[model samples]
Target: MDLSIKGTNFLGYLPSQKGTQTFSTFSCRYQKSNEEVFHQITESELEIALEKASAASEKYALAPIEKRRNFLREIIALLEEHRTLLVQQFSKESSLSEDRGNVELARTQAQIQTYLDFISRKDWNLLHSQELNGVSFEKRLCPIGPVVVFGASNFPFAYSTVGGDVASALAAGNPVIYKANPFHAGLSEMVAGIVLQAAENNDLPDGVFSLVQGNDYWIGETLLKDERVKAVGFTGSVRGGEALLNYAKERKTPIPVFCEMGSLNPVFIFKDAFEGRTKEMVEKLSSAIKNDGGQFCTKPGLLFIEERGSEMFINAMRDEFTSAAAVPLLHPSIYNSFLKLSSVFDRFPVYRVEATAPEYSVYPQLTEMTAKEFSAFPAAKEEVFGPFSIIVKCADESEMKACFETIGGHLAASVWTDQSLSEEWMYLLSSRVGRIIKNGVSTGVAVIDSMHHGGNFPSTSDSRFTAVGKDAIYRFLQPVTLQNFKS
Candidate 1:
């Protein structure tokens, strides 16, 4: 595998550099701009890619499932083959540790393997046959045509180019036009190159996959406005997702937009749980908050605890935050956003921990507030996308429940209790969140058959579908019923 980064857009298999507008990715580790200059995809270049994808969608969709599976298999093999170089580039571009990079890369490969396993099953097509009044009918899943995937900035390998969205879209037989996140454009380009290689090796259609590189908002807007695009897959801030959703709605023929947006995943701690395992819970929560500098969307941004034993837990958390070392975020823009959002906590009682760290690095912070104060302050609910969390001290169980009610939809909410929670409590928590964690942290998301990484409203555009795991492929597929049809 050639591990060179060519700062060009992959318009199908061809590398084109027609656009004069250019940008460069920053090195968070070096605290400076990278040397390579990347070309942005112009409207004309984007139109060509869209046309190719539109032209090849049917061919790719109609291709044998085994062929698609083989393409995915090749991608997995290529990813593993280039793991060392890819991890190096990932760490260099994102300023994340090499271990984190390797872990994310492995997760990316595992995600593809999960899809491969799904497609290999006998009932992979989800075929349902029925007979009524001597009439035969069969229902099966079909591709939704070319899909536009907007890469996420946080998880460069797991959610960016050649990530779950791209893998699931390809598995569902939909041609993908991947819009590379400019934060890690070089890494995205390398991953795109690997996917294109796999497609070529499998004798796939020319437009089965395309990569568009650009930092401008119009690039994504133009992709969403195209009538040929059947659906969209996005993972980013709520604002970014909403913008794409609006663009899709404004189109003459609206398409489904599966967006995995930000969430304020809250953790509720009962008196018994805190008292029984105070030290253990403190370590777990601190680790969750400080993991990857708390850049994950599922990072616990809020913690609800009863006021009786809240002081000890708060002090323990403060101690943990104070001792922790700071780390650089993925980009300057992300660091800037984190600083701006976290400043909102200054109005309330805030305990911050800072270390002697390099540029673009941020320390962990903890903010304290009462349930009533939290409800009164609308900004308290907003997600501060860094190692920052708000601790809400509730007077009683009812107050804690009320705090949960004030929160909008989230990806997950955790309950730390030694005893079983009431039916009412469970029902309310389940209704408000997509996933409920018991006696655990909300940072690590499991990619499995039953995993639900999506949530209601602002957490995701469509709660019906997920953006992770094997079920994610269903987002790019629609059902078709055949009546008395023969092969």
Candidate 2:
């Protein structure tokens, strides 16, 4: 994995007295091979970066919105121009297929476009009402100060480096200090350089977007607690995200931490729907489970199927999963963890379905449990990271409701139904899921303006915010009010 943190000699970049930066040696996970490496950045450097960025933010924001739009347009153009190399890097580092990498790359660019389109729009600004009764009301959107963007390990270009986090932060007129994911440090540097290059060409400030190589959790804690940082964005495991959020809250000057931890996105299938489209459902299931090695946060890890289709669904799920190509997980730890947890599912007494092939060898597995049993069971509530799913068979519609009630918070949910069932259940699920899907797979999250990519509680630190789509800017922007103004 050619894992190397660079610039050890440049400890001067560390955060000042308020910031202490140190680079450490860590093995990279994305690659099949190992390489010793070191990265150097100081707390002082981070502070300076943030300070300079903060200073430039207002000016950057004041620039013609069209110019910002053009910058993102250029970025999209560059992404397309270098699409081939980006695809290759993604495949080599993440062990993803070239096609999947390309799709992600395209989505990443689309995210940039979405942000640009949003920023250029006039309606994104707050609206206000004025009254002649000696009082008026006004509201507006203002960029938060410097933002700390913690990138994800699974997605190098899109979710890491100058991915959605940075893109959204930039769109919000906030300078970003992106902490690259350790797994894709090289890729981070590569993309960060590109972004910096674009910024320089566009006359953006040096500190507007700075990339630091910190391969440890301590660095993130340090940054999260830093008072200069106005906001934070992260995507990773629940434990990791929660830790960051907790640290931020514990700080003397706490800040908003938008941590999209993880989710066991549930796919609910009604008895009628399941019976009619078992084959179609299975095909969709296969694609979703195997999509990008099932690394997406929105991947449907839990399936709620009615009793009648349970047997056929299990068989098809297994058949499709068995045929899925085995790809190396990002790291040996992930691989081992998936193996260990999957074994635990086999040991569970309620497990009903058998695998089409040995579970350990393949990338994803299909395991089944009855909805009643799963609802009553505490152990079944956990999420197993890799391409693993727990099928919950429901006896009836009521059982499905029970299953959902028992399920934990999720990033997204899917209801495979043609006709609306009961309005109560519909409202219940609609209120619960972050991104609700109907008659389709739950995996592919489109990068669009209206897409809601967040959910309540553990699915994300905040329910009202979205991590992707045009609305992502809201994470980096806060509402302001202006009253009795005449321009």
Candidate 3:
């Protein structure tokens, strides 16, 4: 693949724009060890990227839908051909295992293919015209122009460079400018090269797809505030996403910011299910907390259980969690934050539950508190962002209901029950989460047609749209109705 404007072997893309200014650059390092360096990007270079994206959208927005579908097909073909190397690079930059890298890379391709299939099916006749008295009405989806995607640290391939947001925006015929997560800088550049080559193979404009990398927040802010950028797609911490959203709102021409901030993803355990399958539930909850060191946005943070068999279940869960192996977080800042957030339970109200601490400085921690104690302290609801969970013992059904009311929005919420008295509890949980995962953990988010991977405030900026699945393409689509037109 071709290298970028930077004086390094590593690939990068500084979009062709007018009035580009020279920038002061910063170096990229591997997440764990800072020995060897990757490519460097400048905060000022983002200006050109946004300008080029606006220019590309002019052509891409008018391009035939079939041509756009062909672009996605070519991207999938290139991704498959370069899968092995991309996975290896991803594993190196990200602390995740090789198996996880392969799975995420494959999922990225599947996301693109899913969008392609949705557009091809004739049943989805989005372009339709109706004849009225002396006039004709036609309605269709139009691209919202230039969009910027912020890479997710957790799933580098699925949510990063050529991830869901990128595929969705491009599939909707919007020019995309991706701001790669600094944590996985090298991996982002590698994936960007593959995407650029695919774009070239299909004769896409230089601005149709551009990747910008930087070590500062200003770079992201610059893109969000740009008038040329019509929408923003992000997957990261609540603080970071909130910052970008605020910047977008502050702009003279406010644009829509689809920010998928992290979620608490609480799990409620009813008495019937807990008593019937104590051992099964323990293993399931334990397995849920171990994936990627509990770094998923859907990791169950607060678990509610009635006082009946709650003690025994808690003991079983503690044993399973402590015995499991420890996996480090994506970066050091995440590790530090994990320690500080989990340590909040070391106070008077909340206490440790026989946690078998890991050999490393950073590892999983388990804490416990009564519903009465948790209610006393509102700060207990804050997200810890690691392999940590708080088991809450409720006095009764009424107390549990009260506890549920105090909670805020979540991307995913789960309930473990035997289908007895589920209606009432499911209704109570309906407003708390975006997707009610029944009888299963919310750690795994599927890329499918009906999947709703977004939620109300605190979970995401806008609950009306999803960041995953087929519906995600609609985020970049603006409705256009033609009136008094000839068919």
Candidate 4:
């Protein structure tokens, strides 16, 4: 594939080794070693980037809202200029289908446009609170200094360089340093060049946007622990996020680590909706289970059902899953690990439903357990992470409530119900999930201003923010109170 930017583009150029394309960059060695892997961009480069971004952030934050909106609008137009090529490159690297990749491409553009539209009217800095004692009190949102963003592997373009995290950070007037996913290191570098060009064209400061493409996790740890990095945004596994958070906590002046971890996002199937249209629900769910090969953070890992309708739903769901073919997970390591997990599940006492899938692809299966059996079994609560879901049966309303309470926190919880039942279940859902749904699969999350894509505890390190929508910006920002204003 041709490199993205033309002529003298430093960030766009990858270090080619003897005709082989190996994605490698300067990485911080954390384990008994002190060596810079790729000598060009070293710790000094990052320190300089941090200093420049921090200095520019003060001025960037004071820029008028209209100017900021214009900057993003220009970015959107430039992205549109290379839209087709960008989408194609993203698909080729990520192995996503044309339609799915196109949707994500559009979502990324929409996020930019949404932020543009959002800033056009919304005074993100207006502090209008009144005060007593002949003194005025007002609180407003301010940008935290340079933010370090660690992109998730599953989303290359939309969640990598200049993704939602970047969009929100920029909107809040914060500078960014993106650590791109290794799986798409080349693609990440290409997009990072575009962002830098956009920054230059807008007369934004140099070092406002930087990209570090490395294979190791230590670079991320070092960046997080850096005192200049005021905040962090991450989307990935629990193990990875927790490791980074621990590193941040160990820092002398620890910054906020907003890490979005794994979520066994559950889909609750009420009798009314299941009985209303069993086949449709089955088909809808089957596609969701396999969407993007079930790598989404919102992918439903657990399904709750009433005991009376469990059999019917299971049979239909099984029929759909058996026919569904699997795709390779993001990386070979993930695929190998998944196979091991599947084998372990097969040996467990938990009921395992047998199903068929394409050769080398993961097969979907349904494991059914009674209300008491499911609740008593902690194994059922674990997130299998790919095309796998557990069917937890509740004997009745009381059991269902207990099941929801017993279940761990999730990024999202879905409710499938008819009119009356939907109303009845809304209360239960509000308490159980961060993002609640009605009569739909929870796999496809729309990137919009109102969408709350993050959740409590294990779903994310913090419950107050989201990773996929306008709320995502909150992760990079903190409130600043200003007093005694003179106009």
Q: Return the TM-score for each candidate structure.
A: 0.98, 0.88, 0.91, 0.86
Better of 2 and 4 by lDDT: 2
Candidate 3 local lDDT, 334-360, one digit each (tens):
777877777767774333334544432
For model 2, how big is the CA root-mean-square deviation? 4.2
- Top candidate when judged by TM-score against the true structure: 1
Candidate 4 on 235-313: residue-level lDDT in tens? Answer: 8888888899898888899788888888888877777776677887777777777776777888888787866865777
CA error at residue 431 for candidate 4, angstroms: 3.9
- Candidate ordering by lDDT (highest first): 1, 3, 2, 4
User: Model 4 — which ten-residue stretch has the worst lDDT?
Assistant: 27-36
lDDT of each: 0.89, 0.72, 0.76, 0.69
Best by lDDT: 1
lDDT of 2 by residue, 1-487 (tens): 1122233211112322222443322222343353424355555665566677667677777766666777677777767776777676666656667787787788898888888887777767765556666766678888887888888877777788668888998888877888877665556665665676566667765567777676666678778887788899999888989899789878888788998887888888887776677888888877887665677787788888877846777777777766666655765556667778777777543232344433223356777777767877676777777777888877787888877887668888888877775788768777777877888877777788778889987888988998878888888888887766633
lDDT of 4: 0.69
Model 4 Cα shift for residue 481 (angstroms)? 3.0
Provide the lDDT at 134 for model 1.
80
Off by over 4 Å in 1: 354-357
Give the TM-score comparing model 4 with the true structure, all chains together: 0.86
> Which residue ranges in model 2 land beyond 4 Å of their true spot?
1-31, 34-40, 62-66, 129-137, 348-361
Candidate 1 lDDT, tens digit per residue, 1-487?
Answer: 6759878999999999899999998877689998888999988899999999999998998888889999999999999999888998888888889999989999999999999999899978767988887888889899999999999998999999988999999998999999999998999999999999999998899999999999999988899999999999999999999999998888999899999897999999988886787888899998898888899999999999987876777889988887778878989999889889888779897776554567788888889998989999998888899899989999889999988888789999998988988999989987878889999988888889899988887898877778789999999989999998743
Q: What is the C-alpha RMSD of each candidate to the true structure, in Å?
A: 1.2, 4.2, 3.7, 5.6
Candidate 1 similarity to native, TM-score: 0.98
Q: Which rank order by TM-score, best down to worst?
A: 1, 3, 2, 4
Clashes of 3: 0
Worst lDDT 10-window in candidate 2: 9-18
